[model samples]
Target: MQLQVLNSPFSQEQAELLNRILPTLTDQQKLWLSGYLAASQFSGAQAAAPAASQNAGQAVSKDVTIIYGSQSGNSKGLANKAAKTLEGNGYLVTLSSMSDYKPNNLKKVQNLLIVVSTHGEGDPPDNAMTFHEFLHSKRAPKLEGLQFSVLALGDSSYEFFCQTGKQFDDRLEELGGTRLYPRFDCDVDFDEPAAEWLEGVLSSLKDAQGAGAAEAAAAASTLQTIESEYSRTNPFKAEVLDNINLNGRGSNKETHHLELSLEGSGLTFEPGDSLGVYPENDPALVEQLLNELKWSKEDQVTVKQGDVRTLQEALQSYYEITTLTKPLLEKIAPLSTNEGLKELVAQGNGEKLKEYINGRDILDLVRDFGPWGDSAQEFVSILRKIPVRLYSIASSLAANPDEVHLTIGAVRYEANGRERKGVASTYVAERLEPGDHVSVFVQQNENFKLPKNPETPIIMVGPGTGVAPFRSFIQEREETGAEGKSWLFFGDQHFVTDFLYQTEMQKWLKNGALTKLDVAFSRDTEEKVYVQHRMLEQSKELYKWLEEGAVVYICGDEKHMAHDVHNTFIKIIAKEGGLSREKAEEYLAEMQQQKRYQRDVY
Candidate 1:
């Protein structure tokens, strides 16, 4: 009997190969192949069909709103791009900063998309501070009418990648909002992946809109005036007027007071904003790389972004010259003669890869890789883009209209018997002398602004360089002639050595601009004391201020100091307010929900 031929989408070679192998395959193998084709929709050379739009002709509203919470403006940039893309696709989109968003209006949103970045550890970004708290609170209105999506940007190297997005997703569902699409947790290299996800969302909600066509038409007709040029990707180079050592001579640490000119950029920012500065690698390190790799200093190379003259030039100008990633390790693994590198690559452990590269430079990598030659372009391909560092603006716009100031702690550490430096911090603190140019852009942080009601009491917790923004805050309040009471919690190892901006802080206190002053010199006495301990010391009064509508602010280390201060607040609420531990926890949670408690920890 002749058997009928089963024609499939698979290519002829694949079909023939499969048929030849079928007789020798087991039942498990056949089942696996069946499921693979069902899920993957491809077998060897089979071409897959495109997916149909999920919501075609579903009557989508003309008004689309994008809310973004960003610390360094990366999230906001991405959000703006998404809005622009949607507008180009014939949808009317309004972009709003999360800090400025009114929580009461969340229920009125129909087609909503959020782009938020997580801060240190797992906390929400600074701009999303209040919004995140409100969502988890009882005061938040039900979002049942909202159809939303979230694009959470984070660093996968951290333990909590897209933690803020996960929280938002969970909270929105709890409030009965329908998720239009699944939330995407994007890592550092988020550009391509974000674009892909956005396409999916555009396809899914192509037809979902508000009921009225006239209203949609009116909204859609309002065309967006996009910025013609200039962004983090293409920053304008500004001149550095001065970069002086803020710390007194003989001090162990190197801190700088820097000044840069905006000149003709037309960029203006308020006091609470930060300035993102692009820094080049140290010249000494670049020279070392050239010598070790046996490459000429004038060899030109092209990377993913643009072409640059010389491997040293590329490393200094375009790529991250210090930190190493898993991809870079993988790229060099085959050429590496070191047994440690070989074992690490075989294991595929990201953390171990970091360790292997830690405290080592490109020269070290080349040495370990032996005589295996690598082209400059190939080497540059493995490196990540040079990241911009954020520095809190120390001067208020009212004080310096044409310029910005920064308080930088020069990163100087010893590792492997060689001195190491912070990529951007040292660049600004030591390399860029007075009158040199530094590329910079303002990053607005509205969430960390001074209290709207001047009469409201404000308590600020900042230690080390965390004191940077508080200077601006106090200056703003003073300039506005605010009657609000102000309290500051500052600490360092010793009062004599690390009391940054001490003279200015004391002057403010003496002039009555500061209502209360508290200092926590950790190593002053035999026993160490931190700001949280001081908060505990004044628990009764602190709780009284909380009762009297005082606004509490915290900024500094997120891992330990922030957590310690948080615990201290709970203890105060429990003891001073005379509540149980569980109730105290609930009380603090309620305060967060009410936007009475806020943190700006890094």
Candidate 2:
């Protein structure tokens, strides 16, 4: 229905503006607008009431503190967005990273909003470790008058999804703080849920402050039109310039060196940033799923409220089929009549459920639990959207303007009596070619960054694909002619077949952009040596470099390589500096707090 000036409170111009925007908005957008308008009306009504009718005890402070603990910058971005929204609504805002915030100041905060993402196996991100520990410690202060909320981001595929956020939310309430808004635990596709959480928080704040709080509806509407055209929500299609296999023939590993054109996209990135690629599922897997379901390829299904596509097209391009989550199994249980499937998802069967979910896909679920009663649309509704894959950029924007480079390792393995392939990795390695376009966006990482001072020496330890970002670092230093001395320790399986970017590292060392190069080829030696072994071998000089104010950067696998390398650093510090293990640990922690020790491990 069109907005008519005679029947509405809006002026002619306002009615025309509303008419233009209403038809273009999605269902979710319309619902949000309705809620916002209702909140505004309610606030206005409360303000018009007599001052004597107001409850003095319910009055709240206008000051707000937003703290974010981010690994790949998502939480930081959301925290900044929340701060802006609060500021637009006439609230005083103080925004900070969890690592930078002073713990003693917690008792002074009147309102607190935390945005944090859970890392591997439910651990807090590296930057959040200190604060997370402090808040849960015995010396933590009781926050009697504090009002707070939390926004937690995580992958549902993980067993302990959003664990860190949940911990903070419970801890705050235990310390006598009241919840201003309920905590939101978001899955991988968090954009919509996060928006809903922010809107709810704004409504609660407005209700507490009444109409005296400035209205942000007009400002938000204006800001939307000026947002960046390219983002996670709307990625730019970058044309591939080059695609080459970096590994020599006969190597066990396959790594692709890709160069993409960002000439007209206006996307800029630094050395430590990552590139997010949205990849399509394997057509073979999609066909197997279709055949098992006995569903027509041309059946129409709605991906979202307003977006519809063919079943085959949607399965191939939009939905995630490779991984299964506990929540997904629970959602699917009622749709099937299979007793075994239902029993496995029942309470007290968590171990069995976890075992079933590991290394299994949607195809396995359908085959195991036959005769699903739901329609194609209903089945698709329960599945999550395909998550983007992030790779460390391998080239500097300063050295190669309007071009971005990535080093992707193809992932293939045998599991459950069949071969499985990584969606994004294999897509780029086997299918992508020069002149093809891929949807991509740059992911800014504040937690991992090069030092602002060019004269400070840097020590880098990157094995396998972890060497990607260090390549960018060296290229950037070369382009800017920085005087800092840099050292690199890189490792792989075999020197002849698996040594990646060997010639490039040699070139940088020759030009003084890189001062030192150490390589460990595990398979080349009888006993198998890695980068950590090399660090231990050069313990004295490594400790000396640390004493010389050199920054250390590590990038690569988190579970094993990063963990082993971290312990190796402590051993080197203790043995060379003649300190105890405890003191060495403290020294490393201090380095982390000082931003001298940075990691981009996954």
Candidate 3:
């Protein structure tokens, strides 16, 4: 029997004894015994040969769940990395998006790790709406037996920064869940902090004495991913192949059509992905800051990254100087002797501080606060790292191999009696030349993707530069010879001057690639019709298309255009489906869940 059961390793009498002993051991004992055996094996492997052993420590794998709510893939990537790290450390991990998770099952989870990102104005990402609402609703279950942790990623510029993550953290605690690790709030430059937070959570879950080299090795693997070679922290240097001004002369907009070469970058992007550009500050602004601060251009300043460089170079490329935030004001207030600036950031001056920083910059702070005698290094120490600006990819890699494209709108305005320029936008517009290098990274947006099915119909409504991704979508569909009927509703100020990709639209239409083309130029008419108006104008046909399985997509401003479009959709549904507003909202929500409706609003 031993020879039959164990072909080569053991004799029959030994196998019989082992089987009898294994059956007598309890589940908990078996778990510990397994871990002890694994440790023994690891120890032996280390003695014989160190190269092949992973040294998985002595702890058994813990069951853990990780959920992510992502808008532009940051949260999702972080969650994936965390999951991979946890799994590599001998943890049984279950990873999922919030959209696919059932909220009612939260009570059953023993250990959970939530990684969520805050979208525009502190709203939850579209995939998280149902779970977010469910967690806050009365139907949420108590989780007294559950242990959880949260990693919140957000941009600090918004008033309600990391609102979704904060809500989750509070709600989980309120629902009786115990925190295994303290919640981590990460800013836009979140890579290092997030990694540190992951390590902390790992330390919390594992025994401090037993967790050895496995944690470090697993964590190192998490930093680099298999998806793409370039990340926000380590961007690719893509050469600017071409930069054309799309807006004609006399137009109020300064839209630039930038084509960059991604050759040999190992970066691949789909239609809905965005290209993040690390921009340089204007030389004029840098000069002004140096002059105002009375810092010598040659003065060396150590940036937050710990790299020492000239004050002028740091201002031009490292630290953020164009934008003003509440944190900056608070830091500057203590350094300055001005009472007004100090009062603005005082305990009871939240609203006043917000109001004052609306159209201000670093220069504004210096002018209003007065001369700070702090050294250049001291001043630079308090400043934040310059964040990358993401622009939707306007060209399909399938059509334009080895190249990526962007539609940039140069933002120039007058604020506080000084001409202010958008940091990234003006950098692309005025400073960047053909053959110049632009440090770029591809940010995948899975939420706003083209339909996988070739025969599915699509309706795209994009106003202004929002038309960028739609252009990629159309080009992709056309290049693929998709049999789907494609309709585009694009609007701007003028037909000729403000019309982005006009020639391409006409070419697509002439070649039968574009099934429908609708234009709404607000300045072209007296009535000021927009894309939502056009949707209402053609409501009957729009409803018919919806019934025929057409996917509706809206891109652009989230505050006004996306909101108006959403309301317009509800109204259309109510009128066509003959339902109440509540039912109409449900219908749209259902469509959203089914991926029939999507938005790429910024």
Candidate 4:
């Protein structure tokens, strides 16, 4: 339907302009436009009436504050998106990181939106700690006039899925803040739910502030910027240039050093950024699952509303079949005739449910539950899409243009009398080969980045595959001729076979790109000496470096190594600086606020 001057109230040029843009607008855009036009007509009608009636429309607040607490940049990206949306609708938006936002200003905010991702074990992300503390503290003020909404990002696989967001939502309501829209808690697949939350929030805002507030120019500009060549939804397939095992013959571990060619993909990344890989499930596992279910491999299943693939193909590439979640168990329970499966997921069986889900997969569930009662299509319909695995980039773009590198450790373990393999890690280690293509996208992490001043010294503590980003960091410093003094504390099981990138580290040390190196081989020593022990050994010098303003970067196992390393820093600071443990903690927290201490642990 073309807009013409003969039928429409628009001039010939205006009609042509509308016709050109109407076809390009998305369904969401069209909805916004329609609401805006209706509101404008309503406002015009009121403007021509009595002046006394105009006060109510003019009293609506146009200010919105968006704060994000992000660990891997997802929340930050969404926060920025929400800011743009609000701005496009003629609202004055104030977007900030939770660490940077003033808690005292909470009382003044009319409309507030929080986009935060829960970190390890229900804890708030590093950047959100301060704000989270302040909000929950006794000093927190009442927010009677505040209207808020929260979009929480988390993985349902974790025991405390979106716990931090739930805390914020509850706390805000406790302080008398009204919900502009109910909080939305998202699992690993958050894009759709997040978009829905944003739309709902925008609608509520329009209802409250009047939809005539939209700025067409701003909306058009925002729509233009939304176009991207490649993203999480549309990953770029990059060819693998090299794939080699980093461990020697004597090692118990299998770590692959993978180099991918990003030529013509235009996917560039910095040292601190991560590469997200979409990997396929093992064919052997998929075959086993199909055989167990007594389903035909050629059976067609709908992966989504429009996408369809064979049962085998869907299990192999489209859905996540390895890990089992509580939600998955509940969804599949009704389809099963097994009394045991139903009882395990029954109410008041929370502890048992968590125990069962800990080390078991879909295959384990199917085997243990007994005879099933669902078709292949129905089974696959409830499965979540395979989440992309993110590995810290191991090469600098400046040093190796049109290429990206990753250090992936094969995760092979025995649990519940069955051998288990990591989805992406084992895929890279055992299946991927040179010249084979892998779909990838760059995930920017602003929280874990080098200092802007090249001369600032740095201390990096990375154990095992955690050393990946530090490799990129050192390479970047070397390539850019950075004058920063670098110290690296690396640990592994053995010195002989587990010294990953040993030659590269030696070359960088010789060239003075790395100022100091300390390695701890846990098994080689009489006692298990980890990175923390090494740091404690060099406490004096480490304290001196901290005093000299050296930025600290830690990447590795968050459950143990990162936690130990963090405490070790505090111990060193307390012992050397003659401060109490509490004071030392304050010092470390201050460093975090200054962006001198950053972590990229998982």
Instruction: Give each model a TM-score.
Output: 0.76, 0.90, 0.89, 0.89
Model 2: runs farther than 4 Å from truth? Answer: 1-59, 211-226
For residues 1-602, what per-residue lDDT tens digits would candidate 1 score against the true structure?
22224556777777777677788878999897787556443311221111122255243354678999987667887787788767655556878887778878887788889999988878887668778888899998987778888999987545667899899988888998888778988876676667666765675564342224443333333322344344455566788888777665666777788888887887888766788888888888777776776557677887654555667678777777676555567666676567767787776475676677667655566666653436666666666777677787888777677777888888888876667878898888768987788787777665566667789888888877777888887877777788988888887777777888888888989888788878898877999999988888998989998888887877777788988988999999999989999999888766665556767666
Task: Give me the runs in candidate 1 sitting further than 4 Å from their true place.
Answer: 1-69, 84-112, 126-150, 156-225, 228-230, 304-306, 331-342, 347-363, 370-374
Residue 252 C-alpha lDDT in model 1: 74
lDDT of 1 at 31: 97
Estimate, for each residue in 1-602, the C-alpha lDDT of model 4 and write its tens digit: 87779977899999889889899999999999898777656654543443334566455566899999999988988888788776656667999999899999998999999999999999999999999999999999999999999999999888889999999999999999999999999988887788778877887776664443243333434533563677776799999999999999979999999999999987888889999899999989888888888778999988878898999999999999889899888888888888899999999999999998988888898789853646888878788989989899999999999999999999999999988999999999989999899999998899999999999999999999999999999999999999989999999999999999999999999999999999999999787999999999999999999999999999999999999999999999999999999999999999999999999999
Per-candidate Cα lDDT values, in order, are 0.75, 0.90, 0.86, 0.89
For model 2, what is the alpha-carbon lDDT of residue 496?
A: 97
- Per-residue lDDT of 512 in model 4: 99
Strongest candidate by lDDT: 2
- In the range 1-602, model 3's lDDT, one tens digit per residue, is 12345466777888778877877788999998898679657644443432223266332236799999998889998998888777655567899899889888887788899999999998999989989999999999989988899999998778888899999999999999989889999888888888888888887766432445565546545656644567787899999999999999999899999999999998999999999999999999888877887778899987755588998999899888877888777777778788898889899889888988898888877877765647888888778889888898999999999999999999999988999999999999998999899999998888888888989899999999999999999999989999999999999999879989999999999998899999999998888989889988888888888888899888899999999989998999899889999999998998898878988888
